[model samples]
Target: METKKLLKAAAGAMIVAFAISACQTKKTATGQNADPAHNSMNSVDWAGTYQGTLPCADCPGIRYTITLKDDDTYVLKTRYLEKGDSVFTESGTFAWDENGGKITLADRGEKFQVGENKLFHLDMEGNRITGSLAEHYVLTKMTDQITDRYWKLIEVGGQAVADGSTQKEPYIQLNSEGNRVEATGGCNGMGGTYELKEPNRISFSQLIGTLMACENMEVENGLKRALESADSYHVQGDTLQLFRARMAPLAKFVAKGK
Candidate 1:
């Protein structure tokens, strides 16, 4: 009888050990299947400025611009079109959701779903907005370089561009497609091709413009001269400076609606 009892105890111990080993094996398999590498926080190049016009019931629309930094901070600017020129600015930290696909603004509890070169505005419940207006909630990421933006001419020949000096605001847009450039010196429209060589070296060619004369051709003439002589360029934040050799900046521009 004693021998039988000892045999039974040994068999029971073996069964428990086998059960524990099987559990561990199952756990290891489950862990291997969990993919943490494909999330937006790790996979997406999400840092940059994103801009869009969000819908508003009482106003025309809200120009929303949000800049996300790699350090998990954000700057939000909003302007109600046709309301006033005042731009509301907000700055604060943001935290990603547990799934790493969504971020919440710490100050206002606003949420946005992070995606490739875009952000989807989420509702209060942290869910994507649905229906016809859904597409309007998307914000496109802006390039960090001096391309595909409206650069308003603020200074030319070391002088500030006065308000109402020209019929329209002086601005330039560098289109990435075919490296084309379009500008208005607050009067006649101008078009040209621009080449960006090396890091900051730049040149404009095939410049053409409308012959219509305006009351104030000073800004327009200066702009053309600056473009012809600019050999290098510098972009700091929203400001762009054109340089001729090592001399002072020939002209300065600020990114519009930045």
Candidate 2:
């Protein structure tokens, strides 16, 4: 009877030891105590500013600035010169890839590819995105103040200038208050009265201005003709770029400083 009891006790101890060893082995293999949110691909953080120059022959080279946000949204800013005048700002929204490797822009309601790195291509998935790593470009995430200061271009349609020589000298000048804009000829500056129709559009009706001659009356005449031909104006940054449907390139101007 004593031998049997000792044998039973030894068997129980062996079983318990084997069970503990098996649990430790399982824990070692699975890392059960490790962090639940940890990921292996959090190496690249693409939440910042990326800037570059875009090539254009007819106008000054376009300056590009893109800002990314922590929530994965983005904005793009472009500056370019046109017909001896310069436009300083043009902007739109942006999107990013899962691993933070690529970015895209909402170019006229479509998601367009926009990262400097070619490793990952910016592609859209319905409303989501997928892409690879970027190189040679900086991605700066957006902040409150940054968003507040963002400049957007207000697109006004194009117009046709009158047929007289005086009508060809259309020039615009900002009022001392900056609230009103007056132009000379094209026809008359008084005919052009500015109306802030919508948040993104500036309308000019009955545009009129005084008739004057400058050093280069011919060039001034051409400028006036261009301005008179403008059916709409877009104000971006500290500059405005004018567009005409039939014209190949756009016109640009700097905003009057306060």
Candidate 3:
């Protein structure tokens, strides 16, 4: 009877030991199997809005905003600054490369690279993007609530267009309300009304302004032409580009504030 009891105790101890060994082995295997995906997610948390500024050879610094979607997709919007003008915004998309620990952005046929800790830098990470950077964060995943904002222009192409052609000098200004428009003809301030159209379009009409005589008239001539010839408008980044139904290239403006 004693021998049988001892044999039963030994068997129970062996079973418990085997169970412990199996569990340890499973844990080790799991850790080893976690490759790029685990490392990528561990590095950058790309769930919010990202904004930054990068240098461009043709312009000042270009600012950008990137929104990550819940579905693992992303939208990238950027701005290009011109000399003495508002910035221009260019938008596109991107994807996460888990194993590579970097986000692969769509460059519209432009080449981009991704690597661990080698991503472009960014400014603040929040609802409002502010600051400058040379690199963007490498995205790992995206959510659905990413696309929510639309950009508006306070000034027409790089310069403002006035209503009259008689001023001495041509100059532009966005009224204080930012809703009204006006400009300096060579001699006086011209005024006008404008509207935002559908699907990234804008128009100006019911235009009227004051006439005056001044020393300079070149700007007055151009301002008068811009107002009469203006047909359509589009806003990108801080830069605004105007169009004239196959007549001319129109005017371009940057955002009012820096």
RMSD per candidate (Å) reads 14.4, 16.6, 16.0
Off by over 4 Å in 2: 1-41, 82-92, 98-100, 108-258
- Please report, in order, the local distance difference test score of every candidate based on alpha carbons: 0.87, 0.44, 0.49
Ranking by TM-score: 1, 3, 2
> What are the models' TM-scores?
0.50, 0.27, 0.32
Candidate 1 residue lDDT tens string, 34-130: 3467778999999888989999999999988788889998878788888976778788899998767899999799999999999999999998899
lDDT assessment of candidate 1:
0.87
Query: Top model by lDDT, which number?
Result: 1
> 55-131, model 2: which lDDT tens digit per residue?
45776565555555566565555566454423234355565434333345566443433333212222344232323
Of candidates 2 and 1, the better by lDDT: 1
Q: Write the per-residue lDDT of candidate 3 for residues 48-125, one digit (tens) a residue.
A: 455555566787766655555456555565557555434344445665443433355466432222324233433333
Assess candidate 2 and give its TM-score to the true structure.
0.27
Candidate closer to the true structure by TM-score (higher is better), 1 or 2: 1
At residue 4, candidate 2 shows an lDDT of 100
